[model samples]
Target: MRPARLSVVTATTVAVAALATVTGCTAKSDSTAGDGAVQVIAKDDACEVSKTEFPSGHVELAVENKGSKVTEVYLLFPDDRIVTERENIGPGTKAKITAEVKAGSYEIACKPGMKGKGIRQKVTVTGGTAAKRSPEMDAAVAAYRTYVQEQADETLPKVKVFTDAVRAGNIEAAKKAYAPSRIGWERTEPVAESFGDIDPKVDTRADGLEAGQKWTGWHRLEKELWQDKKLGADAKTLADELDKDLLDWQKRVGRAEITPTSMANGAKELLDEVASGKVTGEEERYSHTDLVDFKANVEGAEKSFELLKPVAQKNEPALVTELDKQFAALNTLLDKYRDGADSYEFTSYEKVTKAQRKELSDGVNALAEPLSKLAAAVVK
Candidate 1:
């Protein structure tokens, strides 16, 4: 019912297939043409932009991949909350992305191999009206933060259980704890991206990165524990690395800022992610935990929506009513996948039929349409 996030495994498909795009505050599957959108290229491990500077407000950057392999392009804030991204762009294709950026210094990243850090370009925006945020939006951010922190706090112990299993070379125990432990992290992923470095260390997959990028975290352990069924030295090291990073990350939570615009944008991005990764069954391919992340993303979006609801109810009661109905319908749909426990069963990625995927997609899109407009609707 709630949706997903950006990770390497899913992101590759995201670029070439359906990008996580924002339409107002909603997610739009199609490309949006900007009035004066500029062109950039992803070529042989570089992100080359048409210009280095621009006027702020509504800005569009059109990226084309001339590279031989798949690639991704992102407009990143200093904290690494992606302004907009076009992932999975294959050779000879292009992706058009637009964002509302205020005058400031920003970073442009072109992941040439769609792995690791691609080339980065620094750009400056000249002029634009400052975004006005309200207490309603602030409350939404605060609520989401509390939820994220709680998730992380609860997750640390579970992860220790998992890592301890891996450390002790207990593959059976490690496998059992995997998906459930990840749910805590996956739920708050929209906020997690702001942590930048920690995200990759904790979750990158082998196939998710460009050539030669080191894969680590849960998926790395997933391979040894599930695929190899042998937790070796490298596997233990990865588990230990994840152990330290998760603890350090919790310490950084209070320092991050979650604004109304980002929360609104994150809601749409989460659903867009569902369409790209979870529905396609590209994410958690090895672990078959796509459904787990999918549910968490939805829950995260709901937290964002709940915080914004009072504003919506005052401004547009009809829209609020519609959102409530759609969210319930979607959640009802997701609930069918529950494992009789608090978590979803998902069965297996391959077991999911085309009809099933479409059913989920259609439900998510229905909720997404009304969900996307919430931020701007409330702001107005």
Candidate 2:
């Protein structure tokens, strides 16, 4: 099952601040450090921020997880729309988060177990004009929006094919459709996640569900087809529900908020997803189709980086060069698992050795480090 990206409401104003982050990607300092960054200490029960307020424009959060469990920290708008977030911070580790916020009221939430609403701390951003972005950045955002829309458009029909097989009780056919159905969704997950209500209804895993939430969507059907080896009484109903939910996603995707920073940040989020779930073999435990999802995530990240390359190369040529090299290295590694150059057919994840997994993890981390800085580079 995938690590579910939280859905968010439309926050007309905070759209510009959607600088998503992952562990080890953000930087800031304050009294305890330097560089005008706010300090965040995340404990098992308490979340502490060094400052309750700061100026608008660029802000950094320096987060240290003192908790035993892995934690996630988020910057959220008043209605809890996520402005930016960093996930998968291990115990005793520190990470930095950078965001571009307009003057407004916000909250910092730290989820110790990386679940639920989390502990919230109110924050205020003092008045300042919004950052004036380069035309290239605007062009990148426009292009990314188009890309996201195209992905959404392409995903719905594939999902329908999978659902149709399920409703027909053809387990083998449904299994065949599963991995292909997810490619488009995997490629633009963050955009689907921003709808505030759609993702949980469609892509959520069994473990990722909240209290009172029903088990539905792709994973639920996957379990019935692969693990149970028979159609559950509810299988057809679940398939219909999955089809309906993804239809909702296809309709609502074009309205999602998009920004240059969001595109860059989202690219990093995809890498983080691969590192956390796909490489670990947690996302597709039943089908062992993790490699297909891994490829899609990398493709998504690469698309975003390519769109913003012109501006990022100008601001940090060395970073862009390193990013290109790492991406090539990772793609070459992935190609080894595929049936052919253009096929999604891959060796099952269960057949992969521990060493191979580690190598994949290392490659993702390598690419992620440079991708993490893409948002800051483009916005500059």
Candidate 3:
């Protein structure tokens, strides 16, 4: 990952807020016999499935647990069907199962404690007796791999800049860099919260370089010092001691990461409906509710851009570049409908201004263009 270049002009104007709807689904399907072999491993709340492609029918699945904790894995099909399931596969254990499935889409989820959080791998099973790989599938997988690589490339360098700023006692820089660096982690909330204890105020100060400096970012020395609760006696000393706790709380909030999956999922679901033509009823399809959600997604993405502007300008040029494209795509989408018009409930082209409808259609298509490329890569 390379450092993102920060634009000074844009930094000062950035604003942060919750925006966008996350979207996605989980499902599984059967595998064909004698289709070579399929093996999947579950570890660290993720599933490493063998063979991105699957043939329809009864396929054997072998799952192994390498992590220390107990884990459960499920093979899911579309329509909320579970093709196969294995629970409480303890550390160093393995389980094998077989199931018959039809073609369409599927997902493999390895979850622990039924937390509704886990790694999901999308799978596609083709029809027919002979197992064959489609060229389109191959292209989609390649594209998805590229997308993941791009995101990783875009994220790490910015993270390094944020970490470096913290180490250098550059509080303002660190704060600016925190947003995008923490976006993915935030999606996992409680799990991401355990990463560290941070103090925003004292930690943000420039004096952090001094030998006896107050705690700053993640695991600063103060946490160990005050854990015993034997620091001081006088009011001034006790006040200083209490300040650490306060700072710790602030740090937690500052570094929190909210997962974007839900927002993405919501947007995709609505768009899928529009594409399929099932949502044709003007009253139900173009409801004001749909427009509100679309607006919210746009606003959310803007907020994300705002929060990361400072750091993004300086540390992650690629992300900034990609973001600009994303923004343009979204703006184009929003121009399609009246500010508060019920897009879903839109009965005919005449209901809204032609220009507005064209903008909306174009915007949706524009957003979907990049997203489809990106999605094709990930939702294999």
Candidate 4:
């Protein structure tokens, strides 16, 4: 998920090189005989292709593996369409791919090492039968459409419940509601994991607190601010710090052009804030009220995703379907906490308990997994 943090190691470099090769293409060696013929080569640990434009119809792609490692190539069309795919092209191997296509734009993606950071080549198809359509393509389109509809029907209402519980300050209910909420955002784990260390200091507090007072992560922060009365000024200060940090985080998260390095830096910064006690102040007191509000914000995000899913799916089925899965997981995780918060009544933060904190952490992780995946899937 999140493209595995884009390491600078040989493996990661090779993968990125491949991706760069495929995605960055320019027209080369144009000819009438080569009109319908496209040549793809994997070179310098990347996939490279000749001919950026062609007339649509029956097309043949001559792909040569020039890289040391084996690679697989996929021809993906605009709007999440996959025309055809070939796999297991060993070094020095060459393969020919034939498919009936129409005038449009398509991408050549190469998968190396069985991982997704593949090379993509852009191709433009011109001058073909305007009405030529295939039954198989139609079927795939229909199936994708149905999958998106089902996802929306199943996940939206549950997301609302989880968010409502968090906004209500019902920590017990929030815990219980987190499970279903997690499922709703399962596909967006990469994004959520970036915020995983929202409040790491709570681990120690959770271990030291009474059976019902233990709290961790966001839940721990909530208890510190709203449940624990001993931390007055400290809690307020921590809340202010969190507000600032979260605002910065929101800006980074909302940006359309986020690089793996930028994402990693953001995560490190958040973790550092928690480790330095900047989020909770010198007294190390957490804030329950702040936690509730943060959770609510997370819930609102889920709702926004639910609304966007349909439109995205209609425009890009394959991509949006994957994204929906991530959102589903996130929604499920939130549902667990919401349910937990609703099922129990805690008069004080001390009554929150260790088991609850553990559950909340696990739920958050579950949600984080999918968000991370979605981010990685679209990073390029």
Candidate 5:
């Protein structure tokens, strides 16, 4: 889960929110434009677009934040479905988003504090269809869909185990099942988050709660099991709620919108998840299972990269090589904390030193730089 707190970015900014994983978007500081990309200038209260109408096809939005606060820019369908977005764009920074657009009416929203229903601007995509995809790209999309469904299928039973222990008032058993229960969800979070409504119910942390919003999710139960050190009637009831929410997720996984660029963008989003929450020790404050979640994020990112490697190799061989090198390096570093060769058990995040966390953070940044270009490469 992403923290509600915003971090300042110095050079370049990548998306940190789960909803930002929808389409092809890359975060960069420089606004170098030679290609036909629309310029979007975002101020604290106003959002200005270079053009409101463009032909429907491969559309690109170069977003520049002139605002004082960290901002988020979204390409939304009329119904507010996020087609693509770039979040955590710090003051004076820039980001670029490339999306597959069909002829339709849409909105451009600029959210200054990264909160509320943002300032909206109407945009119309006139006539041509979204560019046709190659069979290889179609195969990639289909494979990724199956992979997401598999993760959802695997997650249900694990979550059931944890919830059953909670319902039975077995604190020790529940604690044992906690981290393992979250592995599948953490791995494919962007896909689950695409549903929008499901995420806050199942994963919202106390600090991340909105105004007047009740805190009821895994983290709430996490606080009870670890911080309070006891399970009560409320905890039992929450376990049931959590189970019901996840069951809904399982039923809806098949309907999620999946695209080749979305997969690549999503891989980078998982790394952003690590940098924002897992490495900071904020995600698992009560349980200290941050390492388990950290490893799962990397694994998930690697899965997407690996699936798209064939197309990426054909288009950007150098990028594939560098990604290969960096992914191996990061995995090697993570392996240092594993309890066994094939085990999910990891050294608690509390035991990891500050210096070690920095090393891990550096490793993530190293890989993220190249992985950020994956979407552009695949679309080539």
Candidate 6:
């Protein structure tokens, strides 16, 4: 068995408030098998079937886990875009993932323990089957892509400003440029997170640095500019490196896909960040700008929700409305600390009372309740 390129991520106790189990935990699907759904059984060693060819259109892959451990299946395109995926398949249960696919060569991967790659099979889809499209799904993906592109566009220039300030030893200007610069990064975090190497450089927390890996990026600059009140030569070089990374990311506009399942999971991931990092004040420990990151996370998650609201409304209208209201309420609650219009300033993290932080935490969990149901409702 070849080692998988992916790492196992475990969710914490905080996630229980929003999700019954964290993402990788076992989840059995109770969905009815559609006519287009293909059943693929997973066992202890290999996938039951492999290297199959199929016609395209509305393609559904029903993956059943007969293995003792939790497993997941991914249908991926050549460019590394995940077209469809079913995760958390416990032993003796099955789940289905449906996607509108086109004529292309794809790969199916089964991951046992949700860790290393179990097995992979190639799939060749011929052009005879017409490509199918869904207006709702298309619109949602387009919106998310546009949002990512816009953020990338904005990030290019902001990063330069921050880097230049650091080079010039302008602590005040660098500090000013830091929080707002992070907004665009945070808003498009789902895509940023896709590139594992870049994400840590863009937003690595100071305390979480691996042994021997030098800490850089926003938090590193945060310490130099705020805590030490000095910007050193090393920090300046890091600033330039960070700027380069952001511009390189800018060039990848429209490269990623924005499926409903991804959006649903992205929203949940953003809130998980809030619960684990923002509310805990661990993300911006040096500068106490956790509120800024919190706002951007909410904005990102809210954008996902807004994009998929139409589809969710069609299936669960009341839940959609309540989700909207909850989101709005959460935004309203966060707005109390807003101190600047164009400046994007907010009350410092330390200044926010424990009660107010609790309110924010409560708001996130509230939104997560209805938001969790969105993927299942829209995927069908």
Say which candidate scores most in TM-score.
2
Encode model 4's per-residue lDDT on 1-380: one tens digit a residue.
11111111122223423545545533346552264568777654555667667777656677778777766566665433345545556788886655555788776666664244456666778985643334433443344334323443444455445445555555566555544442322222223333323222222344333333323323344453345623333443443443444334334333222222223222222222222221123122343221232243344334433433444344456765654564466445434434234522112223345675455445444444333322222222
**Stretch of 10 with least lDDT, candidate 5:** 5-14
**What is the per-residue lDDT of model 1 for residues 246-310, given as tens digits with 9 covering 90 to 100?**
88878877666566656666676677667667888766767777877888778877877888787
Q: Among all windows of ten consecutive residues in candidate 4, which has the lowest summed lDDT? A: 1-10
Q: Report how far off residue 113 is in candidate 5 (Å).
A: 3.7
| Predictions in order: lDDT | 0.70, 0.81, 0.41, 0.43, 0.81, 0.71
lDDT of 2: 0.81
- Residue 149 of model 5 has an lDDT of 90
Local error of candidate 2 at 6, Å?
A: 6.1
Q: Is candidate 2 or candidate 3 better by lDDT?
A: 2
lDDT of 2 by residue, 78-120 (tens): 7665677777889999887777788988878888887776766
The better-scoring model by lDDT among 2 and 6 is 2
Better of 1 and 2 by TM-score: 2
Give the TM-scores of the predictions, in the order they appear.
Answer: 0.74, 0.89, 0.26, 0.33, 0.88, 0.70
lDDT of 6 by residue, 42-77 (tens): 766666432256677656677789899777677766
Off by over 4 Å in 4: 1-39, 44-46, 57-101, 105-121, 130-140, 166-179, 182-380
Off by over 4 Å in 3: 1-35, 130-380
lDDT of 1 at 36: 58
Say what the RMSD of model 5 is. 6.9
Better of 1 and 6 by lDDT: 6
